[model samples]
Target: MISHSSTAHPMPNSVVNLYVYDQSIAGVAKMPLDDFATAFGVPKESINLNSPELRRYFLNHIQIITEAKPWQTHIESVRVINSNDPIVREYQELLLNFICTPVKRTSTRDFTFKYDAIIHQVITHKIMVNVVQDWQGGILGSQVQVGEIALNIPKGQYFPLVVKLQNGSWWKGFGSMVSLGMYHIAEGADHLLFLLVLLLPCMLVPNGQNWGAFASASFGIKHMVKLVTAFTLGHSITLFVGAFQWIRLPQQWVEVWIALSIMISSIHAYRPLFAKKEGWIALGFGFVHGMAFASILMDIRLSAGALAWSILGFNLGIECMQILLLTVVLPLILWLSKRSEYILFRKVVSAISFLIACFWMLERIFFFKQL
Candidate 1:
């Protein structure tokens, strides 16, 4: 089987995957085992499935032609995968990763595939071709069949299969990223909890060692705007830089820090921890949260232009969600600030946020350790 997708490399290329059955593919390359073992021995539990010879064989057989020129093909990696049938039995498949680069930069969208790897020698074998990811075409995390490559029994020849993908545009990819960012924040309960908990005490002043009376609405609004803006600025910086890989952090540590940020905000909500300096604190923690956001972008394959658009779109989506949340909750929070029971309510919420953050931190720590 063969599949195509856009690559994550800086240079534009098409990522093609070739899946060959282990038993069937053994005929294409020499085995490390002896001749007797290769001919009569039972299958070992583990063995090397790919080699230089096999890679060269693949490069010689598979060709992607576009604009009437053959695209350069190279083997990226090879690995064994368990593709067992739940109802039937267990078996393994060899997955060969191929990187096909266009001779001209403008011809990445359409191509003709000419693959004769195992099929060249094993006429009975057929290759299924599919499109697994096409960002511009709005295909992500799903497979759509293109066509198959097989020998014409009557003609006794293999025909080249021309793949015509849906024309992709920059706007479609950018819009999808925006939706992705919005969904990410909407689902990330911990991120929302951190921001909300920090906002809880915005309307209250710090008098002596405790939270004082309700501050004026204008004062609260000014403070909130500063805090939120500081946060946005913080995350945006790291989001841009981190996505480009200028700075990198371990995902587990980022998660741990995010949980820690929530805990700090929750404690500050309960009492005056950093009272008037909440904006700075938000900015600092925002950097940590931004690191977590960058992790999402790192998984996607994009050219430089696509990456830039994705970052902008994703950040806009995040801001939109944050504004929507604040719109719904800000007035309610302000109203509650004037009530006598507001102090108790704040403590309850603060306590809950702190506990939730603690749970998240521990869960991430233990989970990562196990891995």
Candidate 2:
């Protein structure tokens, strides 16, 4: 299989990934003691994987053309990787990475790809071509089929594939990031749990140590708004700094802290540990949660201009989702606060949240120790 992709600040060149089964390449085999072993008409040991002849062979067989001119191609590296598929279980494949550059600066979206590789000698072999990532095309983290390359049995020749990818714009990329952010929060249980636990007692007044009667609707709404804004502000600061790599912490520790934050909030919800100062506590925990959010942006690896847009879109999505959730749940919580049994209901929810957080904390610690 051959994959065409691009990343941040993509140059006027193309990156390709070529996957070939070991059995298709003669003399090269997967052995028990070696990742890639060579057999010259008989069983033998390893050979130089970085041989010039091997590189030349691949470069000669593959071609990427735009207009009437051919691009300069280089074999970056060849790696042996094991397969876990049921059909080819325990088998190994060779990954040949290639970088092709045009003689003159031009767009790489449209090109004619001609690859033979092992299929030149192995008649039954086939090669699949796909576009795995085109950042500008809004094709991040996905695979789209370009075409396949195989011998035309009757004609005894291989057909060249012409690939034309869809055009993309900045809005498309930004919109995708927004959707990703909304999905992340909607799917993240820990983030939702912490927010919900913190908001549990916002509608009630503090009576020295315990939660008192339900406050006026206006007061409750105002307090909730202040608390949510503080949390949002705290995270937004770290999300920006951490995305640019200005501040970073070990992911394991961040995860452990996130779980711990939920546990602490659960305690505060049940007994009003922080009482009227919940907004301050929310701000502190929000900073920790922002670090976790930063890991996502770091993995995206976008360029400066695109990264800025993404950060804005992503944070907007998170806030929108949080507002939506609060809108749906706020009325119910307010009504329950006036009931005589709301204290019991609140304690039950807090206990469950605390136990769930304890489990997550222990799991994250175990993962950290293993690393």
Candidate 3:
């Protein structure tokens, strides 16, 4: 039984459902009553899920169901059953209803009253609470431990804790937040393609219709820095607002637009569309990308001080990754821009990137499930 002097609570009150299972002490073992009394001197279920000062009585039991014992009896009654038949429905219910035990209890010491203040804020909708019990083959102890848990969330299981956000200091999980940003940016193929394709032409001078070597490396570097900074600023704005729940956008639309951005830039490599205004394009399309980034944080339900720190960490990670990628690729692009063969490599890569962007655009629009 749970001790009254115990300081730790089993679980936080945010938990919507609680499950209690009673294990068989004997389990069909040839053991004496004294041994059972000594092993489990006090029944763990005696305290129940709440206070233990109640006079209400509860039963500890298990039921067995087998194909020969149940199906044989149920199958014998069926004769030319149809979809709409009453007997068919009854038989179906019996077959599906494998619940061996039902929970029925009433007590004056209401445990839920502890969360009455915040329950309305969290549980905005009705939830059906069903009870079930099962039998085990081995010796079961008096202690209870949490088993498997399945959450209806994407990426990971986010525990919804009922925290006093007004007074409590936010958790410092900067590394985790940074990792989230790095992983997302790395996996965002369309986003990276759009940025890289635009950057490829940064060093080359646009002469009316054709591309040639830069006037100076400094000039190329200057423009590159400006474009990257602009892109960073554009996304930062929406990421903050979206995390705070001040704005929202559909994910599918954002992904489709992102793919479209990549396609346009890839096409521009073959034919100059934006020319010297790549910075402007990066800033403009960046808002859409920022919204996509915000959706990740919002889905996990981050807020306030924690939200602030996480955003900082995430953005910092993005910048670090961006810088790292540019450091490696920018020099290579500059070296190759002066070569005659580089143009061939550029066009080939651009064509492949455009095709990939096309595929992504179609997939996002059609809601194709990627395996």
Per-residue CA lDDT of model 3 for 1-371, tens digit only, reads 22223323222211112222221111110111222222324343342222222111101111221222211101111111112222222211110111122123221111121111122222221111211111111101223322112232474332222111111122324665676688778887777887888787787777777666655688888888988888899899888988888987777787788898889888887667888887888787778788888877664433376567778878887888788889988888778877888778788888998999999999888875422
Pick by TM-score: 2 or 3, better one:
2
lDDT of 3: 0.52
Q: Name model 2 segments beyond 4 Å from true.
A: 1-83, 89-108, 111-127, 149-162, 368-371
Where is model 3 more than 4 Å wrong at Cα?
Answer: 1-171, 368-371
Tens digits of per-residue lDDT for model 1 on 31-99?
122221222232434444464655666688778787788878777676654544333235445566666
List model 2 lDDT by residue over 1-371, tens digit each.
32224312111112233221111101111122121232111122344458786677767877778898887877767666554433324655565666666778777667777676655655555566766555556655555666667678899887877877677667877787777778879998999999999889899898877888899899988988988999998888888988888998988998999999999999988887888788888898889888888888776656678788888988988998899989977998889888999999999999999999999999998855521
Model 3, residue 244: displacement in angstroms?
1.8
The C-alpha TM-scores of every prediction are 0.76, 0.74, 0.56
How well does candidate 3 score on lDDT at residue 256?
85
Task: Name the top TM-score candidate.
Answer: 1
- Candidates in descending TM-score order: 1, 2, 3
